[model samples]
Target: MFSEKDFIAGQFNTIETASFEWSAPSNIALVKYWGKKENQIPANPSISFTLNNCKTITKLEVAKKSDVSSFSFDLLFEGKPKEDFKPKIQKFFERIEKYCPFLKEYHFKIDTQNTFPHSSGIASSASGMAALAMNIMSLEKALNPAMTEEYFFAKASFLARLGSGSACRSIKGQVVVWGKHAEIDNSSDLFGVEFSDIHPSFKNFQDTILLVDKGEKQVSSTVGHDLMHNHPYSERRFAQAHENLSQMKGVLSKGNVDEFIKIVESEALTLHAMMMTSMPYFILMKPNTLEIINRLWKFRTETHIPVCFTLDAGANVHVLYPENVKEKVLQFIQDELVDYCQKGHYICDQIGDGAKQLN
Candidate 1:
C-alpha cells in the first residue's frame, strides 16, 4: 500500500511530471478456459504462460489542469493514428471511475502502443487492457500510496473485463488465471495460479509472430458463446471442458513436454468441437487454419519434433515450439503453411514475465 504523504491528492499540481510505463507480454492458455459466470468470468480455472516477443508497451502522464476534467489517448494501428478507437478510450475512463472515484476529478492523457496488430487474435485486448489498468492504478497509488499492489491489480483486472474478457489474466504473473475462481469469494479456491515454485522453462523462448490476417471474425466470441449455450450439445461440451482442464493442469505441473503437447493439441481440437457443435453449426476454422494444424501434426510425426498449438475464438493459430526446435518448425511452416497462411502470420515463443511498474 502507498502512504498518505506520498499520496498527494491535488498534488498533481506540486509534481510537475509524473509518468509510468510497462511492457507486458501476451499469454497463451494451455487449457482453454472459456464461458463466463459473473460479468464474463470463466467457469473453470485455467493457466497460461506469457509469451516473450509479443507484448504491449504503455506510458501515462498526469498534469494539473483548470478547464476540463477530461481524458484522451493516442491510439495507433501499425503506427498510424486510430481515432476510431476513441470509444475504447472512453470506456477505459468510465471503468476507472468505478474503481477510483477520484479519477473523475483529474484530466489525464494516456499513450499506448501495441507491438502486435489490433484485434488480430494475438491477445491485443489482453495487453491493451493491462496497460490501461496498470497505468491508471499507478496514478491512484501516487496520490495515496496506501493501496495494496495486488489488490490494485486485481481490481483493475476485474474492471478491465468490462472492456475485454481475457484481460483478467493480464493482471498477474508469468502464469495467470481467469473467471470467478480467481475471485477471493469463490468457494472452489481454484483461481489463477502462477508457476512460481519451479525454475522457469520458458524464459529464453522467442516468438516469431505469424500474422495470418487482421480481418475481424464473422461471429464475435460473445455471440459464439451464446450459441454454444443454446446448442443441445452445450452440456456435454461443458463436461468435456472440465475434464480437459484437469488434464492440462497435470501436464503443465509435471513440465512434461510430451504430455503437454498431447493435452494442448487435444484441447485445441475440443474447443473447435464445441464451436462446431453449436446449434447453428458455425465453423470458425478456415481451410488454411486446418492446414496449419495438419502441418504441425505431420511435422511432429515425421521429424519427431514437438510443437504445441492453441486457438482462441478466431481463425488465427498460435504455434508454440521450443527455441531449439524453432528452425525445424520455421522451415516446416515455410514449406507447408506459408502458401495458405496470411502474409504476416508467424508468432512463435513460450512463457513470459508478469506485470510490474516501469519507469
Candidate 2:
C-alpha cells in the first residue's frame, strides 16, 4: 500500500557524478506466461531459470540537479545513442517515477550493452530492465543509507516489473517464479520470488541456445500478449499454467528431469499454440525450428542423454540439460543442431548466480 506520499526524500544535496553498473541475466520460462492484466500483471503464474553469459550490463551515471522533479535522462546502447529505446524508457520512468524519489534530484545517463545480439530470441528486455532496476536501487541506497536489504530487493524487482513483466523475475536468483501462486509462500503479482527450495542437481543446469532464426518475430511480444485478450483458449491456458506451476515445484525439488522435460516442452508448444490460434493466426516458428526439435528427440533417444528442448516465442530452441552431460550435449549441438541455426551460430550458457554489481 505504499505510494508517492509515503516517501521522504531531500537529505544531503551536494552529490555529483555517481555511477553504478549492474549486469542481469535473461531468463528462460519453463511455464510461459503469455498474457497479462493491467499494470503488467501476468495472466498466470510462471517459473523460469535465470541464465548466465546471455545478459545485459547497464551503467547509470547520475548527477544531482533539482530537488524534486520528473525524470530527465540520456539513454545509450553499447556506447551509442539509441533513439529507439528512449521512448520506452520515458514511458517506464513515467510509470514508476513517483516511487523513486531519488530520480527527481538526479539526471541519469544510462549506457547499456547486451552479451547476445538483439532479436535473437533472448530476453534482452528482461536483462536490460533488471540491470536498470539494480542501478536505480544503487542510487537509492547511496541517497538513503537507512533502507533495509529486504526492502531494497523488493523495490528493485518492483521497479523492474514496471518496465517488463519478465524483468521482475530477472532481478532474483538461480530460479524465480513470477506471479501469485497458491503453491508458493508469500508469492505475489507485484514482484517475483526466488525459487529457494530446489535440489542441488537443478542448480547446475545448462541452457544451450540454438538460434534457429536470428531475425525479429513477425508478431512482437507486446502484440502477442494483447491478442490473448480475445484468444479462445486464454482461460484454459492460464489454468494449465497454474496446474503446471504447482507440479513444477515437485519436479524441481525431487530433481525429476523426465517430468521436467515433459512439462517444459509441453509449455513451449502450448505457448506457440496460443500464438497460432490468435485472431491474426500467425506463426513464429520456422521450418528449421521443427527440424531441430525432431533432431533433439532422436538424439535423446539414441544416446540416452538427458537433453530436452524448450522454445521461447521466437524460432530459436534452448537445449536444456544437466551440467554433467555437457560434453555429449555440446557434441550433439555441433553435429545436429548447428546446421538448423542461422549461420550456424549458437550460445552456450548455464544457470547463473543471479544479477551482480560490477563495482
Candidate 3:
C-alpha cells in the first residue's frame, strides 16, 4: 500500500503528507536530436532508448497551503546539495505553470538522486529532468485526482524539454520520439517500441564507450545548437539527420545491420562537420580522438569486423561492433586505444530501460 500521510500544515488544512517515487532512465540517441527552435523545440523528431545504468530516482511530496503561494524544492546530486541547479529547477516550475496551472497552488518538496556520475558525459540531465517532471505529475494527481496518465506524460515532457533537449525523450519508455512532428502540441508519439524492434538480424551489434579525453568539451550542446544558425554546413547537417532517422527506421523494420551502421556513423560525422564549420570554427577532435577513429577504421579494414564509430558532442568515442565480435573489438580498443586514453576513463554498458514509477 502507498502512504498518504500529511507532513506539512496547509491553509486549507494542516499536517498533510503524501509521497510518490519515480525513476527515469538515461537515453542514447539511435538517431540524434540536434538543433532546436526558439525555446528549445527540436528541429526534427529523434528516437532513443532508456538506459538501465544511468538514471535518477525522484521523490516528491506536495502540501496544500492557503497562506504560502509558492512551491519550493531542495535538490541533491549524489546526496550533496547542488544549489547551482536551482535556477533550472525554477525555470522548470515556470514552464509547468504555463502548461499546468493547477500546480500553482500546491507547495512542493522534491528529492532527487542520480545513479551515475553527474560529470560523466552520460546524459545525466536527461534522466534527472525526466524524473523530476514525472514526480511533479504524480503530485498533481494526488491533489486533483482528475489528471490522466497521458496528461502526466504530456505536461512532464514539456517541462523536461526546458531542462534539456535530450530529456524530452526520457519521459517515456523504450523508443521515444521528441519534437513537434511527434505531436502537434507537447506530447510523446508513442509509449515506445520494444528493444527487440531494433532488428533481429543485428543482434551482434554493440557499442563501446571510449573516453579519448575526459577534459570538458569546449563547445556545449547549447552553444553548439546556437552555432548551427550561422554554420555553413547547417543545411547539410539538418538534411543528414532527417535522412539518418528515416534510414535507421528502415534498418529497424528490415533487420538490416549494414544499413544501420552506415547511417548511424555517417550521421554522427555530419553533426561534427557542422560544428567545425560554425563561425569561429571549433574543432572537438583532439589528437587522441582522431587516433582512436583512425585505428578503428584500420582495424575494421584489416580484420573485416562489422564495426563503426560514432561521436556525440563530446570527445568520447562510442564504438559500434557486432555482438559476436565484442571481445575482439574490446581488445582492439584496449591495445590500440587505451594507452592514449586518460586514467579513470572509458566504462562500457549496453542499451537500457525506460522511465517507471517505483513502489
TM-score winner among the candidates? 2
Candidate ranking under TM-score, highest first, comes to 2, 3, 1
lDDT of 3 at 317: 80
lDDT, residue 154, model 3: 60
Cα deviation in Å at residue 3, candidate 2?
10
> 39-79, model 2: which lDDT tens digit per residue?
89999999999998999999999987865656788998999
Q: For candidate 1, what is the lDDT?
A: 0.64
Ranking by lDDT: 2, 3, 1
> TM-scores of the models, in the given order?
0.83, 0.95, 0.84
**Which structure is stronger by lDDT: 2 or 3?**
2
The candidate, 1 or 3, that scores higher on TM-score is: 3
Model 3 accuracy (lDDT, Cα): 0.68
lDDT of 3 at 172: 67
CA RMSD of each candidate after superposition: 4.6, 2.1, 5.8
* Candidate 2: segments with Cα more than 4 A from true spot: 1-14, 67-70
